[model samples]
Structures are given as structure tokens and as C-alpha cells.
Target: MEMLYAKWLFNGKEILKGLGCVSHNNMVVDLLPIKLAKKTYPEAVVKDYGEGVLFSGFVNAHTHLDLSNVSIEPYLGFVKWLKTMIETKVQANETQTDEAIKKALDSLIKSGVCAVADISNTLKSCNYLKKIPKAIVFFENYSLRKKQAQEKIAYIENNIENIRQTYKMKIDVTAHSVYSTHRDLLGYTMLKNNPKFGSDLFSFHFLESEFENPFVNSRGDLFEMLQEKGLIDNQLHFSSAIEYIKSLGDIKKGLFVHCVHIKPDEIEYLKSIDASIVIAPRSNYYISKSLPNLELLKNSGINVAIGTDSLASNWDLNIINELKFLYKHYSHIDPAYFFGIATTGGYTALNLHIGFKKGFYAYPFFMETTTNNALEEILQ
Candidate 1:
């Protein structure tokens, strides 16, 4: 509603005192040219700090904030932690959940995250997200048993249609994980959906753990687990993690989460498909005691994004903190480049727009590396 100036804002290229001003509502608004700056009548005026780095809001491409109500503790292994998570579900009640999700969302927003490609297991937090103008939800589906695939896919497809019609916010279906989703189900979703439904930018976990690698390649542990649970039998044939996805043929355009155990050859294969990657370093460390081979992904010319996974596996859903952790652990990573990954990379992967107009802009005061500008001073 009101006009304000920023030293810079990201476009195809960065603009400084350009013909656009950030609106009071935080969406980027077009302004009169710098030459007309003095003549433009203003209802209210604000000045740029002239030194801070201003850019579009960050996009967290992967998260499970519904589990935000759960407490995080050190775990022994991936499967072990998952078991604990299942056991603790009954203990996490509404009050704790409300506090955690609300706080996590607040922290993410304050750190300048405008959009998230969050995975939802249910509609519990759906209403809360609907209330926010920025956040979006992707209801994820996870079914490993081959027989259950069709029914589960139908449920997801119907649920997605329902959510889109019901809410003003955007909603989509994220295929759970390479190991968790059955081959037939993946094929049906990609085939039946076609241009509109199939290959609809599906998100899933891939090669995040050693156990997953074998389970997918040879129907190992998870297969055995399913068998023990009476979900599957010995007859179900399985393929390699990436191979099963490749078998889908036409499905490209996707987000692959947590490639921690991803090999060099697998990275090459992923590169062939042209899908992007979202590395949840903190979450990876918390669950698997490992981090992704960012060096490999970067070297392969793969576009990388960042995500603060759910509170169950992550301590906080703060993108700034995630970026900071990335900077600290991976010393070779440039802060500006990593910031771009968090914003532009994520936005492009999920097909979302960002600008000052959306209050989806980030001001990285730390980029200067000299002045610790107070929040008010830098924002002004």
C-alpha cells in the first residue's frame, strides 16, 4: 500500500534503486524510474539502508511440519529413529503440536521464507497453513506394498483434488520415497496423470540411507519388514532405487530429497533426468548421521536447494539457520550462492514466484561480514 526503497532486489539480474519498490505488504511493486523518484507523490515514504542485500524470500522445498509437535532426540540409526517416531505419536497432543507448528512457521517467516514444499501426512495442520498467505502444502503418499498401491494412489489423487478446491492455497501430491512407493503405483500416477496429472513435479526421498539402497535394489530390509507386517510376500520383484524411477520413462521434472547415500554414478543418472535436489543437511544428520555429497551434486552442475525437514527429524524449521549450518559445515560454499539455492533454486523447482511484494523477500545482513546491523537498522 505504501512505497519503500531497497538497495537491491533480485530479478534475472539484481537491480539497485530500480523502477520497483517493496510494498508495505512486502510484495515487490513497480515504481516510477529513479529519475522520477523526487517527483512521485507518496502516501508514506521509507528509505533504503543502502548496504543490506535484499532478495526474494527463501523457499523450503521439503518439510513435514505436521510432525512439528514431536520432540527430537538423538537416535541410533535411521530405522531405529523411525520406530521411535511411530511410538511417540500418541504422546504428541494438540497443545504441543500447536505451539511447535506455530513457532516453527513463525521462525521460518521471520527468517524470510515465503513458500515451502512441505509434505503432509494428514490435514491436521492444513487449516493452520491455509490461514497463512505464504505457505503451501503437498500431501505425500507412502505405500510400499504392491497390492495397496492403486487404492492409495486413488486416495491421494482424490485428496489433492479436494484440497485444491477447498483452499485458496496451492496443494499437490508428493510421492513419498523411492523405497517406500511401489512400482505399479508410481507408474499409474505418472501414466494416468499425463501432462496434467502425471509427472506433476513429484517429490520423494532417494538414496538417503544404506538400508534403503539395498531394500530398493534387492528388496532387502524394508521388503522383509513389509513381509513381517503381512503387507507383502516373496513374489514381489524389486529394482534399484533410481532404476525403478527411471522405469517410469516420461516422469522427469521432480524434486529428489536427501541424497545422502547417493553415489557418484547415481548423481550422473540424476543429472541425466534434469530434476533438481533439495538437501536437508540438519535432518540428514539427525536421522541418518550423515550429510549429502554436495560437492558431487555441485560438480555435476545440478541445481541444489535447501529444506528444514519436519521438527521430528529437525530441531528447527528456520531456513536461515539451515543456510548458516550449510555455510559452516561446507566451507567451500559461497553464502550468496547458498542463499540463491534457498530462494531462487527452491522457487524454480517448485514453480513459485517471489518478490518484495509478497513479503517474501530476504535481507541478509550477514552478507556484509563487517557490520552486525540491528534488525530495525538493516530492515529500514
Candidate 2:
């Protein structure tokens, strides 16, 4: 047993404990209003470093660990960056894949991130996450080709099962996005969602850009871009992107990424379904130069979470950076309440079994503070 003292400890529900002791499996076993536990082995113990805030390690709800090679690319317009992303990948090379992943992981840990919802495009980063303390992998699937959607879904299903069998790690499917995924692929993937894989969480790229709005709703600019880039063939028809996703069967409990361009009706529809939204503010600003309507989201009572996205688009991968940015942009939203979105809201969105379980699960970390305000003390 080991005992440590922090100014504050954050339990699952934002409960602050002045001092706490964390046991093996990296869970907070005991916490107190005022340093309550007695040390059994004083001589063998390490010194208590005093006067610092400790909260449950931060949780980054969305990130692309594989895209760690990202540097400054063109910001503002969607098509410019999308074109660059397509053309630049072959040149970036894979030697830095490990280094970038390592750097991002290290940065997450240093920032007190205990868990992450990392979206994986391939198995390259899976090995790195295998050794991390806590991580949930989101295997990304994309199939815009009509003839290839079925095959793509089949591939994703098999790959997910393979990953589960190999690492015994928690894995979930994230249909790449409304614009990149075909209707059939989305439907098939949702229909194949099984409890056997220990993955019930669903995530998908939503409206991050105004370009995607008309394109997904009526297959407008997206279709033209696809044809121009040789990425699409037929003229697809859909009433709305949200409607297309809903048609993919019931995904009432999934995570919807980047609702910046989400229409009011779509937001209402999503709320009616009990779905949560993961806002990638930095990435949103990087791509679209605008922030989502936080006031509307708040008033709608929709659960909103935070994500740093990948370094390719954002300056950093730290969730704290995300929080600080949010503080700057959406001044109306409470920092303390938003912190929960980064931690508990994100964790729950991925269906992670959080908190303390005697034999099953372990609480990762806690926020400790002399004051009752968890966010104020930690930020200070």
C-alpha cells in the first residue's frame, strides 16, 4: 500500500478529497476530507510532496494517435487541408510513427491523462497503447465507395474481433464520418454491434464543416469533390446526414464527434436519442475557423465532451490545452462543469467501466484540493 498527499483529489463525480491513497491496479482506494488514513510503514515510505493539485488524470475523448506526424498545415478551408492530407501522407513516412505516438502518449501522461479515446486508422498504434496504463482503441472504418461498403464493414468486423482476441483490449468501431462512409457500411456496422466484444460504444465523424452540411444532406459539394478527386461515382441522395445515421439502426448511446455544423433540428433529434457529443474545439477552429454553439448545446441538456483531436490539426494533444481554449472561446460555459465533460462525460461515452470495483475495475486517480471548487484549485 502507498499513501500520497495532494491538495485535491477528483473522484468520479467531482467529489474532492484533500488527501488520498492509491493502491495497485492504479485505483484510488481511500480518500479523506482531511488526511484520514494512518501510514503503516512510515520508514519505508516516500516523502509526501506538498501543495499541488491532483485530479483524476485528464481524459482526452478524441484523438488520432496514428496521425502524430502532423505539423502546421493550411488552416481555414476544409478542401485545402483535405487535399493536403491526401497528398502529404506518403511523404511523412512511418519511421516517426512510433516517435510521434510515444511523444503524444508521454504528453498525455505528463498532463495527468489516465485514459484516452484514441481513434486508430490502423494497428500501428495498437502496440504502443498495449503498454499504456489506460486506453480504449477506436478502430476507424471508412468506405465511400458504393460497391466496397459491404466488404469494408466485413473487414472492420473481422479486424475488431481480431484485435479483441489478440490484445484483450477494449475496442470499438467509429464509422469515419457522414461524408466518408456509405449508408450501407454504416448500417452494417451498427447492425453488427455485439456485446460479446465488450464494445457497445459507437462514434462517428459528424458535421465539422459547413461544406459537409449540404454535401451530406443532399450530396452536393461532397459529391463534386469526390468526383473531382476520383473518390466517388454515383450521385447519392440523402435527406440529412443525421437521418442517414439514424437509418443505420438505433445508436442512441454513441458519441458524435464535431457537431459544429449540426443544424438545430439535428441537435434536437440527437438529444431525443440520448446521444452525447464530443467537441473537438481546437480541431474545429483549425479546420473551420469557428466554434460550436456551446450555449445551445448547454441549454438543450445534451451531454457535451471534449477532445484535443490529433496534433496534425491542433497545436497540442493535452486536454488541459483544450480546456484553456474553451475558457477563452466559450466564456459563458463554466470551467468546472466543462472539466467533467473531459473526464466523466468522455469516459462514459466510450462505455468505460469507471470508478472502484473490488475485483473488476479500479479508479484511476482523484482530484485533491483544500477548497471545494475542483476546477479553480487545479487550474490555479
Candidate 3:
């Protein structure tokens, strides 16, 4: 029995002026003109959010909630950051990781994130995501050795369902990247999970660094570390990450994360597969001193979403702060475009319904502004 009117309302798409959102029993009922809404709900209590835009909160398409407690600083290059993060993981106790997961979820909630696509190694964050309306916990397959990959595969085959039931979380196994996961593990997990769930768009950390190109082809530092006693030189090597992955099978609609170094032909391939990508701009700048081509991605037909990565790689897990960063630095792109990816594109990527739909839950948030450039004002 509430009627909330705003100067502008965003429905995960276009912004409409002078609309009222009607909700009852804590669920959104309809959106209509203020006058029409009045006629529809004659006895409802009303509140006008004057000089502002009211929107359903954002969907964070990709993040590592488990690393929320890991401290990060700028200018720590990718390799060093990875080493530091590994050291911290080795040292951090179970309680510490649990606390970090709780804090990360709380931060995302307070920052107005409606849903999340969280990358987890242990599915520990799954325990704390009760408050989020939609959540996808991607358990990473990051074994560099065949033995480790075999052990993990055995565990997944025997205990994945039991673990999911125990956690009460939708945990799906997926590859970490070209350098970390073995080719066998990648194909097995992806082929195993990609068709079971209707929206089985398992995410991959693809091409976040320029070094990955050489690493995948067995010519980089990462490749040297990946060498094991029984592993053949070309057992895991490929012409490109995309080619190796495509060799696995035709997994249409895969989610590619941090595509900072995605090439032109690769972009065309992504479009052809109807793929989605999540961009972590701040994390890229912090680790590699480069941001993805936001202008180009904005024009690309592939579904695009945004992420904050983790505190281990970036400052924080606030999608708003991330959007603001993109708005300020990547000024060539329109602010609304950033906003769109943060909302609709992210939901699309995660296979969740767009917010503000009737008969659905909408965690509404707002930006107070009188300017016609409300999106720009809020973002800047």
C-alpha cells in the first residue's frame, strides 16, 4: 500500500520522467504516470522523491567476494599481486576468510547491488549470500598440474551435488583461466555444467592481461610455472585462448570476464557466439596499467556487464564506485551506457530478470539530482 513517485525512474533500460512505482505486500505491483497511479490506488500512502532518479539496484556480474579482506595497492603488477594474494590465502585462517566474505556481502548490499556473480575457490561466500536476491557462485578450477586436476575432478564427480545441497547455493565448477587450469579440467567442467542449468553461462577469466596471450602459447613466465614432470609441451598450449576453448566444444553464451586484451577478431567471435563479457576497469588499471576499450565495448553487440573484481586487485567492491570511476576516466563513453551495463546488461549476463519488472522483487535505490543530466551528475 505504498505509492512512490520520482522525478525520473529507471526500469533497467530507459529513464522515464514523472512515474510512480506502486508496491504492496513488499512487492512492486506496477509503474505508471503519477495521475494514473493515483486513480489506480486512491487510498495508498504517497511519497514523492523529488529531484532525483529512482532505480532498481545494480547487478554485479563478476567479483571475488572471498578476497574482500586482502589488501591491495596500486602499481603492484599482475605477477606480484598474484604472489601476494596466494601468500595471503595460504596464511588466512578459516574464520578470517568467513569474516571477509561477510564483510564483502554487506558492502555489496549497502552499495545497492541487487544480485551478484561471485567467483569463489571454496564456495565459502555461498554461506553468506542469503540477503542477495540473485547469486551465482562459480567454484574455480585452478589446478596447474594434472594430478591436482584429477583430484579436483574426482571430488566434483563424487561431492558436488552434496556440497551444493549442504551450502544451499548454486555452485558450478568452471575454469580460472588459460594459465591456471589444465585443458582437460576446463573441457570437463564446462561441458559438464554448461547444459544442466538453463542459464548455465559459466564465466571464465579471459584475457585480463596481455601476458595471457603468450602464456597460452607456451612462451611466457606463466607457461614456465605451469610445467610439470609428466606434462607434454603442447598438452595445454593453444594458438589462442579462444581457439583452445572452442576446441573443447560449442558452448554458446559463455561469460568472459575482464576482457582487457580481447582483440578485434575475438570481439567478432564473441558476437557470433552470443557471448557476454564483464569488465573490471579499476582492477585492470591497478594490476596492468590498462583499461579495456570502453568505447568499443559500448558499440559491440555482445552483452557487456561491469564488475569491481576483488579488494585484492582493486580498491573496493562497490559497483557504484566502479561506475563512477569509469564515468570520470572513460569520458568518451556516455554515462547512461555505464549505468545500463551495471544494471540490465549485468542481469542479462547472470541470466536474471531485469529489475523493476512487475510481479518481481526490486531493491530500489536513488540519486538525488535536479539536473537533466541526472545520470552524469550521479556518476560524476
Candidate 4:
């Protein structure tokens, strides 16, 4: 048994002072006032981390471990960066990919991330994720040709089954995006009644770039790129990316990543579906030179979360660094709110229980601080 007292303690939901957590067998048993903890566990050892903040371990809601080796230089546009990523992957080998995955995992663990919702095209990181029990592997699917959708689905299903049997890790399937995946493929994965197609959790990139809008409308550089690759037909037509996704069927209660280009009505629609909006502000800015309309998301009463995206688009995979970026740019929002998003919002999106409560794993993170507002200082 051990007791840990910190200047500020975030118990998943809110921040409190003069509180200490009691741990037994690597699980949190109780959280009470420091005095009460001392009285309750008189025989237990106490360790007070003065002038610091203690909170639940971070949850990286979205990342691509396979793409961790890609360059982090800011691209002129999202499409240019994506094309470069594809080219870079062609040049990369199995050894390099595995090494990059190992480095990314080490960086995440050292930075205090306890859970992750990793997106993977090849599911190459399945072996690594098996060691991190809280990880949810999102097997990505992208096929713009209806004729090839079934084949792609079969491959994804096979991979999912194999991963489940071998690693025993949580797995789910998701469309790459509205523009990148065919309507038939999206419908088959999201609307099909078969147990194989249904997962309680689903995630997809949405409105990450303005080019997606024009691509969905069949009138942009992205559309031309698709045409050059013979990925889209002339018959394709959608007013907006969000509308096209909504037409697929109900996709509520899932992580909608990179909602950086959504509008007011679309925000309301997302809220009506009870979706969790995950914003990777740094990645958005790095690739597209734009950030999400956070004020709109906040005003709409939507549940917001944070993600590092991947080393491809981000400088590092630190959730605290992501929060600091948010606080530095959007200073009006409370740091506590961002903390909640980094902790509870991420765990909720991954379908895992927050560990800050009793009986759960007490994987607490400590941030050095001197100010009374430890969260704010940590962000600084």
C-alpha cells in the first residue's frame, strides 16, 4: 500500500486540492484529503510530490504508428504531403517500419501515454500494441472502386481475425475518409448488419482539408488526382463531405478525427449524432496551415478530444505537448478542459474506462509546477 499526495489532483472529471490517492497492487483504492489519507492509512508509506500536479495517464486518441518514419516538414498542402507520404512508404522497407514503430512506442510510453487509438493500413503494429493492453487498433480501409470494395473488405476482415487471434488486442475497421473511400465501401462497413461489420467503436478522418470539400463536390485538385488514378467515377456527386458520410447511415458514438473544416450546421449535425470530435490542432496547422474552429465546437456543446495524429504530421507524440500547443494558441479555453479531453475524452473514444477512479489502474502522471494552477503552468 502507498499514498501519493500532490498539490493538485485531477480525478478524471475535475481538479481538487489537498487530496491524495491510495494505491494497492497497482490500482487506485481511494482518493481523499491528505489528512484523511494519513489517518486512514497510518501504516502505509506516504510520498508527497510537492508543487506538482497529478492526473490520469494520457490517451492518444489517434495516431499512425506505421507512418511514424515519414518526414515532419510542413507541406505546402495536404495533398502534396499525402503524396509524399505514399512515395516515402514505397521506399521504406520492413526493417525501417518496425524500427520506427519501436521508436514511436518508446516515445509515447516515456511521454506518459497509457492508451492509444492507433490507425493502421497494414496493422503492422499489432504485435507492439498487444503489449499495451489499452490500445485500440483501427484497421484503415480505402477503396474508391466499388468493384474492389469487397476484396478490400475481405482483406480487412482477415487481418482483423488474425490480429484478434494472435494478439488479443481490440480491433475495429474504419473508412479512410469520404473522398478516399467509396460510398459502397463505407456503407458495407458502417451499415451492414453482420457482426463482422459492426463494432461499438469506429473512427475516420473527416473534413481534414478544404480540398476534401471540392473533392466531394467532384471539382478540385483532389478530384483530378482521383481521376488521374481512376479512383472516382464521373457519376460521383456530394454536396459536402459530412453530408456524404451521414448519407451512409448512423455513425454516432465514434471518434471523428480532424474536423478542422466543418461548418456550423455540420457541427450541429455531429452533435445530434453524439459523436466525439478529435482535434489535432498542431497537425492541422502543420499540413493545412489551418486549425479547427474550436469556439464553434465549444459553443455547440460537443465532446472534444485531442490527438498527436502521428510523427508524420507532428513533431512528437506527446499529449502534454499537444495540450501546451492548445493552451498557447487558444488561451481563452481553460486548461482543465483540455486536461479532461486528453484524459477522459481519449479513454472514452477508445472504449476504455478512465483509470482515475477506484478499482481501476492508477496510472497517474506527474507534472512539475510551482504555480497554483498546475495545469496552466504545465502547459507553459
> Each model's RMSD to truth, in Å?
4.4, 3.5, 2.4, 2.0
Candidate 1 vs 4: which has more TM-score: 4
Where does model 4 exceed 4 Å of error? 131-133
The total number of steric clashes, by the backbone 3 Å criterion, in model 4 comes to: 0
Q: Provide the overall lDDT of each model, using Cα atoms, as 2-decimal numbers.
A: 0.66, 0.69, 0.79, 0.80
Clashes by residue pair, model 4: none
- For model 3, which pairs clash? none
Segments of candidate 2 deviating more than 4 angstroms? 12-24, 39-49, 72-74, 157-159, 192-199, 355-374, 377-380
Q: Would you estimate the TM-scores of all the predictions?
A: 0.82, 0.86, 0.92, 0.94
Q: Worst ten-residue run, lDDT, model 1? A: 367-376
For candidate 1, the clash count comes to 11
Q: Encode model 1's per-residue lDDT on 206-237: one tens digit a residue.
A: 77777775675545665565556564432433
Please, what's the RMSD in Å of model 4? 2.0
Candidate 3's displacement at residue 261, Å, is 0.5
Residues 1-380 of candidate 3 have per-residue lDDT tens digits of 88887898888767888888888754788888999999989988898878898888798888988777678668777766665665565445778777877888888998889889889886768878877877888888667677788888787777877888888866767778877787667776666344443346678998887768777777775555445333333554678888877787766576899998888788888888778989999999888688888877777777899988988788788889999988888877767788889998988887776577778667778878979988888887
Candidate number achieving the greatest TM-score relative to the actual structure: 4
What is the lDDT, from 0 to 100, of the residue 91 in candidate 2? Answer: 42
